[model samples]
Target: MEEIFDECWNSKGIQVFVKRDDLIHPIISGNKWRKLKNYIQTFSLNEHSGILSFGGAYSNHLFALAFVGHSLRIPTVGIVRGEELIITSNPYLNQMNDWGMRLHFVARSLYRDKEIPSEYENYLCIPEGGYGSQAIDGMDNLVHELPSCDAIYCAIGTGATAIGIARATSVLVTGILTLNNRAEIEDHLKDFPAANLKLDDKYIFGKYAKSNADLETFCRDFYEKHQIAIEPIYTGRMFYALVDHIKNGHIAPDSKLVAIHTGGIK
Candidate 1:
């Protein structure tokens, strides 16, 4: 974890630190590495034909999995969400291709099923956003590296990271939802203990993968001031919510708060 020194945090009377899990690797950085670690380690190439996962056009999970497949020399297949992406050439998809991940695009309707299609059923299916039990187990181990604090905060995409951290730590875990799917996220976390878990959806900006001028300005100014790259998709929103919470007296004064930089900045 890296300590963030800024006037905003200081003025709020809160000590804030960010877990630099993003620094773990250049390609498979942050919680991506942590979440995929156990799955990759235990995966047997001989036992299964290949690994199949799901994601969107710019999914960090897909990017990281492509790298993992390249490094491990395993055949990886990505079931893309949007069929339109199949005819389009983009950096993310291009990189996945270069990494030897076979791309299969499906309609948004079928993608909502959240299951690997029957034809690819032979391959080991990893869930979208890497939110399976293995990922939770991996992230639970990540919590061991964190220092004790009054509160822990992270951006919630699939809620796997937040749920994993919440289950492993005694401190209150505040998950800032980047998407406007509070009910779905709540259902996902139903099985987990809620003793000190909180979900905040006030700073989604518009919706998942959508941003506005205010968010862009904040991200630009924040990067200039702190030299920490934060994308509006995840980290930026979490930080914005943190600042807002602190300013509004939601977060207690002088509390040591740890904000997890879950990466995917690029």
Candidate 2:
């Protein structure tokens, strides 16, 4: 888990150091690996029984959980948000199904609270993005990877990673919100003891995982310029925002910024 801090001297004279968390692990890496580590350690997982929970479709957590649970010989279940959709062309859902995760799709509204039926109460339910106390414990340990940094920047999804990092580290954190639900994020972060948490509302391209031509171009140019691959869902937007913030002189030149690259480049 060595953090890469190499400076890329590009042709355009733009210098950037890439922390390649994408190379963390083949099946489980980045934030997902760190978040799941404690859960696997603390819980006594049997040969064919464990509960993993997440959204209906396009959930990175569900995908990662299915992969890890299967590898560890634990039978997993994904408590998805929203009613079941028609069985058609859905790559994400189909992939999870192939991975042997029991997909349970409930009403979108109820999925938020995750009040499961009485019959299934015994299962070890892992919340979306593995939030709650367990996730905080795992993320708090992530500081061991980077003991010293002036600031940390990570993409904001459910705010789990941000909250965990903010809770774990004393360094200033810049969480780039990637969705329109700012109020929800603020509400979530309120639970943490905030000493260095700084939420920025500028990077969310008006929607979650939605990108305009400029963003797309930035993604393309970023790869072409630095050979660092970033997904549009999380890391791409955060990296772009970081570059923008630097260009705007928001971060001092002397201050070292460590961008947490949670691998989602699928």
Instruction: Indicate which candidate wins on lDDT.
Output: 1
209-256 in candidate 2: lDDT tens per residue? 775788888878878866777777788889888888766767765566
* Window of ten residues with lowest summed lDDT in model 1: 188-197
TM-score of each: 0.95, 0.87
| TM-score, predicted candidate 1 vs. hidden true structure | 0.95
Q: Where is the poorest 10-residue window by lDDT in model 2? A: 3-12
Candidate 2 lDDT (Cα, 0 to 1) = 0.73
Write one digit per residue (lDDT tens) for candidate 1, span 81-160: 98877624688898899999999889999899976767777788888899877887787767888888999999999888
Displacement of the residue 85 alpha carbon in candidate 2, Å? 2.3
User: Model 2 TM-score?
Assistant: 0.87
lDDT of each: 0.85, 0.73
What are the clash counts of all predictions, listed in order?
1, 0
